[model samples]
Target: MATLEGPDVQASDGESDDGEDIPPLGENDNIDAIVESIWVQMAFDIMYVSPNPKDHRKPAYVLLDQEARTSTTPATFQRSDLTGIFRSVLYRELTSSQWETVVFDSFFPLPNSAALKRQGFRAASYYKKWHHLMARLRRRDIVVVRNELRRQFRTLLWVPHPDTDRMWRTRSSMRGFTRLPASSTGPCPLIAINRQALQGTRITLNPPIDDVEQGEMDEEDF
Candidate 1:
């Protein structure tokens, strides 16, 4: 957490005056759970590859799953609740003018089918519009930060794709689903959530990172 010494001192420690943790956007369980679980099957969902530290090499992106989604409508995104620094970093990534390819995870197809449709209602139409915006950004080869699959769900699904199951053929390599036969698309920045897997295994979204402390003491009975 950043320091808060100026006028915004009240916003520090993730708390409100009445004493409640300022919940992250879309952290709700019932609504977000459904969104993430379904997005794991969406056709266009992707996971960026982080670079190797030992080699000291720039990160290279890979296409984990190519046939994840069939949505021709594209994707749209809206950024909210993030700090100015993070938002600026994201914009810089998008405007970096680098050649890039958006890869897919196994979860892409399912979410596209579930969330996108021309239902003729204002809410549904707006939803589709947002997704379209995201797709357009990807077309520009921008590094996106918004949750393409489960934006509403505070949690992420790191599990397997619905269509196929996979197991590790090597300790560091994965088999099953689909692999890049002979595609060398070059290097680009990797985008992923801060949280890691549960017990360093299984696909799972990590909880929020806490840096500040918040507490309150009432003097009612005392």
Candidate 2:
């Protein structure tokens, strides 16, 4: 028969601060389980990771709220939060080059089934605009875009919330959702939220063709 001795852990009936049902603090469930249970928005601009001698990497950025102020503690960010940075950099580059992604999207109209139409693809009014813009894109442009993005990311002083994200301590690698499936990760807020998926993708309005420039004069269209 088992007998009560030291302070034994007590189980709760799903009672927590703000009615949250939190598991008691212990080394039992592991950080991953605790993180997985959290359904809050994964907008943490900061995080706290216990130090270990075996782990040598550091968090890249300061805590979110402490952005305006200097902080010794590094911020913890969820993998999905990086979408904002990606969008910002992409849009900025596009805007700088006066590329209207919205209009560029018209190249492939949706609910689309028929290919090449009866006019051999010229019948669609958007086809002309799409080709005109695409023709301006040279192989160099693609390379330059890719290079610029890589360079900008390298310049970021911030570190991933989980150092394991920057794993391969001595080697360089891209932040990943797949590289390390078993890697310890921040709570996934985007996936945790209970929401219904959209029935269909949002429709982008067709902008005027006047916004598109003739682009640089090239002897051969790419």
Query: Candidate 1's residue-wise lDDT over 1-222, tens digit each?
Result: 112122222212333222334432222223333333334323133221112224455321221223322331122112222221110111112111110111132222222333232222112223333343233232212122233332332233121111223210111222322221112122222222212211233221111122111111223334
For 69-180, candidate 2 gives per-residue lDDT tens digits of 2232212211223332211110011121112122112212221223223222334333333232222223343233334333332222222222212211211223322221
- All candidates' TM-scores? 0.19, 0.16
Best by TM-score: 1
Q: Candidate 1 — which residues are off by over 4 angstroms?
A: 1-38, 41-44, 47-60, 63-152, 157-186, 196-222
Where is the poorest 10-residue window by lDDT in model 2? Answer: 189-198
Query: Model 1: how large is the Cα RMSD against the reference?
Result: 23.3
C-alpha local distance difference test of each model: 0.24, 0.24
